[model samples]
Target: MGTATKAILTVLLAFLIFGAAYASSGLSIKSELKAVTIKYSLEGTPYIDYVGLQLPEIEDQISGISQDTTKILLSRFYATGLLYNASKANENGYFTWSGELKMRVRVGQMTTDVNVPTTINLYGEYDADGFLRSGRGNLTTCIITISLYPPYTIGLSNPINYSFDLNSQTVNLGEITQLTGIVSLFATTTALIVALTKDKDLTLISET
Candidate 1:
């Protein structure tokens, strides 16, 4: 092979190696509605929902943890009943709704196995008409703040805990609240490669 050809091949080889090492352009999140259901009573029916876990931002904030960038997810807590709780066919059921917050932080290729703090707060209210309404259809209305701190050890059963300070304005949970976070596609890829590399007998060669 010619020297020029070898040089070109070397460059290609470097990129290939880098590509293998660099898996994510940003972080990513895996989320699910851990639990959700609707309850019925003579007065009214209440809805209950739960978000399993919030993910990290996959775009925008690709860099490590930053205050300017945030990774947060808001959840709504729901319930309903009338002033007089009743199960009879003629009475209406009183209902109430609330919300809780959970946070997940991602650093580099590792989604630091940390205990995320979550709290359920009253987020819904009933009107004179007996209609259930939330501050917003979803908690997306609130400006969420995300702060990534250094990785720390968390027990298998212990997770970070955070509670929302209830206010008159925060209640009613008829609908689902969106959970948002900072996840990196790049970071994910990095993690996969590291794991695979550990078990592989790797080989490298320049491309022409």
Candidate 2:
């Protein structure tokens, strides 16, 4: 082979290898609601209907534990309700309205189901309107961070054990960054209450 031809082949081979490693450019995650349930307060013709996790920021903050650049998926926690308490239905029939959250990361490539934990729970609840309301949880995948300190380390971190209180606004939940992947699926309902609620109180509580 000619010298120029050999040189070109070498460059091409290098490019191919590099592409395979970072070809993903950025991270793209696909998800969908696995199990879903809905309950009415008054009777028929629902006034409020919602589902999915809550306090997205909290879950992001916890699961965001990374070593370097956070290109790796660690552990993840998911819940069926977030806007409020996720109570248990008087009965377990079957329902699937479905829900999910899509995210674009700066850079990452890895299988999420590897060497990590994924958790999902739904406590369910009854809203102030006498209807059920407990949609308790935060969502997302991912982390642990360490701080530099001496032996004088003070006892800190999520004070309780097991998990956060899934029934309250201050409840705990894996919690992510640059982080615009705030998934709040409880924003809409068959009654369109989310639109009005978002302006009056929902947004305010979420921001806090």
- Name the lDDT of candidate 2: 0.30
Error of 1 at 48 (Å): 26
127-197 per-residue lDDT for model 2 (tens digits): 43222233433223233222344332222223111222222222112122102222221211212343344
Supply candidate 1's per-residue lDDT for 5: 59
Each candidate structure's count of clashing pairs = 47, 31
Residue 152 accuracy (lDDT) in model 1: 40
lDDT of 1: 0.30
- TM-scores, all candidates, are 0.20, 0.19
Off by over 4 Å in 1: 1-103, 125-133, 136-208
Instruction: Please give, for residues 9-65, the per-residue lDDT of candidate 1 as tens digits.
Output: 556655644543343221222232112122212113233322221112222321222
Lowest lDDT sum, 10 consecutive residues, model 2, at 170-179
